[model samples]
Every structure is written in C-alpha cells, then in structure tokens.
Target: MTSAQNIVVFEHDKHYFTEEQKRLKLDEVLENYYGDYSPFFKLIRNGVKFNQYVGVLKVGNTTIEVLPKADGNDKDTWRQLLIDMIKTVWGFEIKVSSSADLKLKSNSILDLYFELYTKELEYLLHRGLIKRYNKKEGNLYALKGALQFSKHLSQNLVHHERFYVKYSNYDVNHKIHCILYKALKLINKTNNKPDLNSRIGALLLNFPEMGDIKITESTFDNIVYDRKNHHYEKALQIARLLLLNYYPDVSQGRNNVLALMFDMNRLWEQFVYVVLKRELRVTDFKVKSQVSKEFWRSEAGTKSRMKPDIVLESRNNTIVLDTKWKNLYDNGPSSEDLRQMYAYHHYYKATKTALIYPGEEGKMIKGKYSPIEGNANASDNTCGIAFISTHTDIVIWKKNIISFIKENFFHVIEEG
Candidate 1:
C-alpha cells in the first residue's frame, strides 16, 4: 500500500496533478462520488475545480481539504477559520481535553469532526452505556416472551433442546448504539492517523456490538429523545453527519469515499444571521433568517416565495440584508443581486437593504432607487453594498459587522 497523501486546495481553485499523483485515481473516485452522490466539484481535464463548497474529502488513501479563502490567508489559517465557522454555526461543542493528541494533530477538517465524535463516544462510555429493551427473535434454551409456532415446529423438530422465541432483551443493543457503531466502523475504514485510530479502536472495543443496520434518510426520523438518553444527543448528531455523507463503492469496495462539504454561500448567510441574532439578543429589534414572503401564485395554487437572508424588524422599520461569500474588490454588485434587493424592499417593506460581502478596507457603497416612470414621487427606500473585512479574527469581524449594522440602521432602534 502507498503512503497516505494530504492535499489542500483553496475554494474555486483548480489542482492539476503530476504523473505520480495521477496514479492515485482520486479524479476517478471524485467523478464516481459526484455521479453517485454530491456534485460539489467539477472535473476538468486532468484536474478538479472546487466550487463554493468547502470541506474535506477522502478517497482511499488521499485526503483533500478544500478551504475557502476570501483574503490573502494561508490554507492552514483558512482551515481553522472554516472549522471555527462551522462550530459556531452548527453549535458543535468539542469536549476533548486541551492537551489531547487529536486536538494537536488534526490536520484536516474531517479529522476535527472525527476527533469530536470519538471524544463524545469516550465520554458516553465513561458515563456508562445505556441499555434499552429491544425485540429479539432467537433460539433460546427457555421460552421467554412469545413463541413462533411455525418456525419453532420446523427448526426445533430436529433439535428438541432449543426453542425459537421472540422476547424483549433489555441490553446495550439499540438504534443509537447501532448508529455510533456504524460511524466508528466507518471512521476505522476512512481514518489513517494512528493516534486517532487507536482511540477509535478503543471506543469500538468498549462499546457494545450492535446489529448491522441499513441507514437511510428516514433512519433517524423516528428517534425520540428525553432525559434518560439525553446525553447521546450530541454523539448521535455527529454520528448522523458521518454516516449519511459516506458513499461506499459497492462495485469494488476500493474507492470508499466520505465527503463533508457545506455550501459557502449558505454558510455565509447563516453565519451572518446567527451573529446578528446573537448581537441583537438584548435589543428591541429581532433578527430573522430567510424571512419568506409569497410573491406569486400560479393558477394551480402553486406559490413562489422570496426570502431575504437577514431581516431586522422593530415596531417601525425593517432592514433586509443578503450575504454573498465572494470577494468584491473594487467591483459593483451584480444586476441580479440588486434586483433581488429591490424585490425585498417592495415585499418586506424594508426601509433599508444591503448586500454584504467579504472586502478590503473602505469598500462600502450607498445608492438610492429611482422612482417609477410615470410616478412623480421618488421612492424613499435605499440600498447599500457593505463589506466586512475577513483578515482579522472572527470575534473582531463579528463585532465590526454588528457595529456597521447598528450604525447604518441606527434610526430603527432610535425610533423604537
């Protein structure tokens, strides 16, 4: 087996391979994964171009980390930035010790998540695995709950010492454990780090073995959570993320792929919304994300809706904000984005609307909409192009964003 290779590519960047690198067949594996699962990357002539989606992908022995870079930061900085953004946006709490080896040696975003899952499982194992009552059908020496007459007659006819019985066996084998076990097995297959693999192996050994299960979209649909098993919530969430995104090569089992990707556009929008909501928590104004309003309806009762990324509403005014994750260095907003803001102003009755993007210093532009052709009155609504610098720490960036919003929309809170 060849040694594992770790490659890092920035967002929207293309990577062409050397002759030695081409033999890894990562392109073929990515193409297969794209066909079978998500089309996150575009396959060019001997290379792959990552789009707005940024995350980690593992194909056999190679780990590719696609990171988003808005400013002139290195891949490692952007990698940590992406991790921090995801942890903040998705509410993932990494509970490992400060000096843990996994924390020190996590090179990829996937490794961070894997380490989180492992630590979560470690905590659960320390607390003690919970036992649940499960319906099991097996050949038991003594009849317990119910007896299957047809199967018992056919099977027990030859061996009179056993009985085919169906009973409630209260043990550690349950759906939650099954999902965790499946995730552990997947990690064991996908991970190559020795330290993390050792922890995963220990977790697998300590955790009770569970029956193999076919995980589908509806696998966790019916899960009920309460105080008794409330601790498993975090572990199960990470497990779901691991188990669902994995696409196994059923044909040869050689190119098993696991992709953990998130759209940068959606992530940027959510990050802005969450930060705004958190900043405005103690204020009179309330922040909402994807505030939808039906703009059109068809004859067949089909409806079309318009959603603005962030909406700040008080008793008097509303401000709509749309976040774009691209850099707009000395450039103007697109006509499509401007039209979308115009629609938001008309529909949401927003007094002010703006398009937010990652930018250099002093890149804010302000403009007003012209009145209708025949109308004598000019519209009072206004739109803005605001940019937040990403070269600083996230905490400073968040504070600057909130300051810019409150300063520009000061009238809303003042009037309230």
Candidate 2:
C-alpha cells in the first residue's frame, strides 16, 4: 500500500542546505517513514510492510524507489545498478541546471553505497569466504562463480599448448578470445571451483601466442565475434580475473619467490617516487631510462646505456634515484647496478644520487670508504651518494619514501 512520489522542489533552496543539514534531514526521514539500514522484511497490522532494502530512501512525503533490474544478490549486479543510477542522476542534474547555477549539489549516495559494499567485501575476504591465491607459488583456494573466473583464465593460459598452435595465424584479439573461450569452458565445467594458479598459468601461456599476432581486421572481427557470441566478455575481463582472484598474498613475508620478484621493482619505484616528490618539491619526475638523450651517455660501454628507475628534477636540484628490487641486506648492490647508477649521477650532474633498495635498513651516507663491513665500497660523497633501504611492501615503502624525501630533500631545500 506504500506509494512512491517524485517531488521537484526549488533547486536553489535544496542547494542552499549544508551537507550536515541534508544528512540530518535524510536520517530523520529514514527513521520516521522508511526502515533503517538493515536486511529484513516486516508486515504491519495495516497493509504496510517495511522492506529492508538499503536502495530505497525517503524524503518528506516522497519515497525515492530505485528499481534494480538485475539480481540484487549478485554483487556485480548491485554495483552496475548503482553506477547506472549515479550516471543518470548526474546527467539529469547537469541538463536541468543553467550554466550560471553556482550552487549545484553533488550527491554522495552512490559513493556511500560503494563504501559499504567495499567494507563488506573486505570483511568477506578477511574472514576467508573469498580467498586470494598466488599464481606464482601454485597455491589453489576454492572460490565460486565470478571469483573463480580469473583462476580459470590463468589455468587455460598455462595448460593449453594447442591453443597457441591453433591460433598461430590469428590476430592478438582472436588469439586472446580463443584462449578466454577455452578457459571459460574449463571454468564452467568445474562449476566455479577451480585452481586459481592454474587459471593464471593459462593466461600467461597465451601471451606468447599473441606476441606475434598483428592487430588488424581479423583482430577486430575476432573481438566482435567473441564479445557477442563467446563465453567471455572482453580482454579486460581476463585481466580482472587475474587481479581479483589470483592476487598472490605477498604479506606472508615474501614466501613466494616469484611474487617477491614481481612486486619488488614496482614497490621500489613507487617508494622512490613518493620520497622525491614529498622531500624535494619535485613533482615532475619520470621513471626508467628516458631523460634528455642528447645530454647523457651510456655508462656500460660505447653501446650499452644505463637507465635509472627514478629521475627527479626541480629548479634547484636534480636527483637520480636507482631502485634495486633486491634485498640490500642480503644481496647488496652488484658492481653493474652501482656502476649504472654512478653513470647516471655523473652524466646527469645530479645534485643528489640515491641507490634505493628493498629492506628496513637505515640510510647509509657514503663515508670515506665502505662502513657496513663487507658492503660495497662507496665511490664518493660530494655527489651526495647514499644507500637508502626500505621495506619491500608497497604501503610501507610509500611511507618510508615520503618520510625520507621530507627529511632529506625538503630540509635541504628549506635550508638553501
């Protein structure tokens, strides 16, 4: 017997309300007319029943009912529905408002829903309903439906040798589609419970197949064919499957050797970047090799060029940072890596030179000679040569980098 109403009030008046006021009003309406945020259904003595669907909201005498076209139980379905609503409301509001309208209200209802969804998902993942598996270590965890999609894709890549042979002449798109189709079939047969590592292996196996496949008319046709008729959706679907389902748990103290190698370089680079940006006020920094080619020469020989992972340049200082993914405490810097970074520092005339490596070891400024016992000998100190070690984890590395930059680079700048 409850009816929904659409009431269009003066946009100016609604826009005038503060965020706090709007929130208070929304809470009041929900408490009085609509059921609170909970999953339940209740029947009253009168012909009125309270539905615990969080999508429904009430304001004054009007009830805003968002009808979800897809299965609400499916997480993806709910996500897509919320996204569609947000886009619709945003487009409508933009179209209705004049260019002169300064007080246009932007709603965070969709963001709130997403936040709630994320919290629940995180809880589920932590509680072990949805588990993460490592592709490199060959760890298999049971996940059903879309959660297992990535695992299946990976397995198809590694196990299917004939897939490469079959799609030899096909374009990249076609080859990828062929692999995806095979993988999906394999996954579907298992009723969603499949080995995550095997799926990742499958995807990797197909990469070599598509390496030589040209992107041409055949490729476009293949994409259309696969998207419209095949079991899998898109190339990104394959990627998502790997990222979501088979994301190797790197938190186990780098137990997976492959994961350590895979994540180390990326984490090291990010750490150096964060540090340089925060400390030196050097926002314009780039990664890997390409600087002013005209100004620099290769350090290895007459032919081989040396490339630093991070290059930060400001008006006052130029910093050349070389990030080694290896654990400095264990491996230390090889003569080749040190030579490469030294070449970069010397060639670039970088005011500061950092050989950044992965570990929790403290900063080591180049003394008269090497100080860490059997550690690699320090080449010089005037160029501000330093060895900075940080944790391998991306989050910890980021924090360390920022702190290092603030203390070293920023302090120097401020002092100067």
Candidate 3:
C-alpha cells in the first residue's frame, strides 16, 4: 500500500507553482504538447511536463517534474500533475517514501498535497526564509523573502510585536524602540501591570492562527525575553485605552498635554451624564452618537437641525449642551460652533443653552448671555446661553462640570 505521508509529500512537491504560473504553464503545455486536448481528454489527462524547468537550473536539484494539465476529473490527477511539474521545472529530486509498503492507495491526493504545502510554508516562515522587512520599521517597510518570489502568498500572519522580538537585536533603531516600549506599556496596562516576563509570554501565546503555525508556550516566552522588539504606534493606541479605563483620575490631571485633552473629553461626557441624572432629577441620560445627521449637515442646516449632546427637560426648564473638545480657556468658541449651539437652544425651545469646552490653565468661564437682553428679541433671552469650560484632567473636570450644572441649571429648576 502507498503510505499517506508519501502521497502528501508527492502531491505538495508537485503543485509548487503559484496559481498564476500554474495557469500559464498549463495553458502553454496544452497548446504546445497536447494541442489543447478535447474537453474529455483534457479532463482525463493526469498532469503535463513543462518544456523547461527554470528552478532546477538555479537550485541544481533534480527530480522536479511538471505534471500534465488536468481537465479536473480525478483529485489524484491534479496532485500528480503538480508533483510532475515541480520535478520538471525545479529539478528537485523527490523519492516517494512509504512506511508500510511502497505502493498503497490514498483517498484524496489534493487534500494531502495541501496539508504538506501548508507545513512547508509554515516551516519556511519560522526558519526566517520568510521574515518581516525590518522589525524597527513595522509593517510599513516589509520586503519580500526569497521564498516569497516563488509563492505569491501574503504574509498576513505577521504581527508587529512578533517581528520586533525576532529581529530587534540584529538592528536597533531608537524611534522604533520607543514605539515598541510604549506598546508594551499599554499591553501591561491591559494585563494589570503584570511583570515584563508575564506580558511577553501572553503576547507570544496569542499568535494569530495561520495555515499550520502552532505556537507553543515556551516559544512565546522566548520571544518575549528576546528584548529587541519595538513598535510605537500600536503601543500608543493601547496606552490610550488603558489610560481611559484603568486610571481615569490620574490620566485626567497628567502633566502630558495630550493626556489632558483626552481626559477632559471623557470626563466632560461622564459629568454630563451624572449631573443630568442626579441634579436635574432625570434618569434617562444616554450617550448620544456623534454621527447624528444634525452634526454632519452644512453650516446653515446644522445651525437649524443639530441636536445638543446633552438634553434635559422638565416641566418648566429645558437645557441643551454642546460639548466641545477644543481648548476653551485659551481660545474661545469659534463663531461657527457657538452659532450652531445657539441654534440648538432656539430650535429646541430650551430655556438654558451651554457650550462646553476643555478648560485651559488657570482659566474657567461660567456665565449666562442673552442675545435678547442686548438688541436681540425677548425670545432669545428666554433661551439663555452660557459658555462653560471644565479642566482637562478627568477627575477635576468631572467635579467642575457637576458643580457648574448644579449652580446654574439646578438652582433654576429649584427656584421655578
């Protein structure tokens, strides 16, 4: 009997050509040798031999064969064709090996062939025959491996972290290292600041699945310990999430200017949700999607249609708030954003209108305005407008927002 292993190897080695090349070679062979055999004959023919074997000359290996073209009838025909083609073209000598007997029957040669090819490709990638372009450059700078030319398969299984650890020591780039360091920091935040050893192990163990690449625990651990990997952008995103979730308070007040910006936006929303529920005595507060139609309309349409981020309504008073992510302390509202907010107040018929922005260093704005009180109409005064700025630090911003709402809107609700 023919052993399954030998059959698989034979099939794999046969169809070594890529899909495009295989198609071209088969077309040429059919036109030249078999004269494009009749559909019936084409279907039945097992495999064709290529006129020339380019790989064999370069590699100096014999036993490569290019099988005749198949009409797609039997499965074995395709496998046999590939094996024959590889032998003829690449000239790699291959001897069929069997455990029990030299000649046994197998169920499906195509399946066996695919299995063998998967294993081979995986081995090549792991052995660095197919490697990342440069660990420091991340995915942007990847180059094709030698084997890549032979097989035009994409290196989708490659991850930035894996590439860094594998090739970091060979060449060190400072900028790339900083990125990798930040990425590790974010991952650590995700894992509750576990030791470096533990974090590295987790990353390796989480290898994305590919054709047949198996990740062992030890392999993962070794990659982590290797210490050369660096990827910055990925680290920054992860760190951002960690800062938002784990240490919201610390992130809000961090000396890092960007950190302040991020914290302010998050806390501003949170405070709005809390105050609307607690002070306004309303429980139905919800996070509105930023992609509302009103938000995207042209300036004129948006001024007429935009919904405020927060809407609080009672028997006598209705309050609408538009949250601004910009620095409100240093720079006041753009005429455009403020005008839009005013429109929301008017259109919604709300008694109170506020444009909220991130407060700057030692500056906070809390006051009411009425276009009617000046030369504007009394209707505009009925819709009081205010500009409120809250600190960028998450904890402080949250407190300031709540306090501002209480002093402004809550008092009105009580007085009424």
Q: Against the unseen true structure, what C-alpha lDDT does each candidate score?
A: 0.81, 0.38, 0.37
Pairs of colliding residues, candidate 1: none
lDDT of 3 at 51: 31
Ranking by lDDT: 1, 2, 3
Across residues 1-416, which tens digit of lDDT does each residue of candidate 3 receive?
01111111221123333354344343333234235552212322344333311111000111122222212234344344333333222222222111222121232222222222222223323433212334322332344222232122244354432221123423232332333334333333322112333534544344332222222334223333222222222233333332332221143221111110113243345445554454334433322323233434575764434546777665666667776544343456677866666666556666766766543322334444445545656445333334444332334544565666667677656554
* lDDT score for candidate 3 against the true structure: 0.37
Q: Give each model a TM-score.
A: 0.92, 0.35, 0.32
Taking all chains together, the TM-score of candidate 1 against the true structure is 0.92
Error of 2 at 266 (Å): 6.1
> Between 1 and 2, whose TM-score is larger?
1
Show model 2 residue runs off by greater than 4 Å: 1-267, 270-303, 329-332, 367-394, 412-416
Worst 10 residues of 1 by lDDT: 93-102
Clashes found in each candidate (C-alpha, N, C closer than 3 A)? 0, 17, 38
RMSD in order of candidates: 2.6, 23.1, 30.4
Cα lDDT tens digits, model 1, 272-379, are 888787777545578888878999999999999998889888878788999999876657788899899999988998878999887655356889878888864546
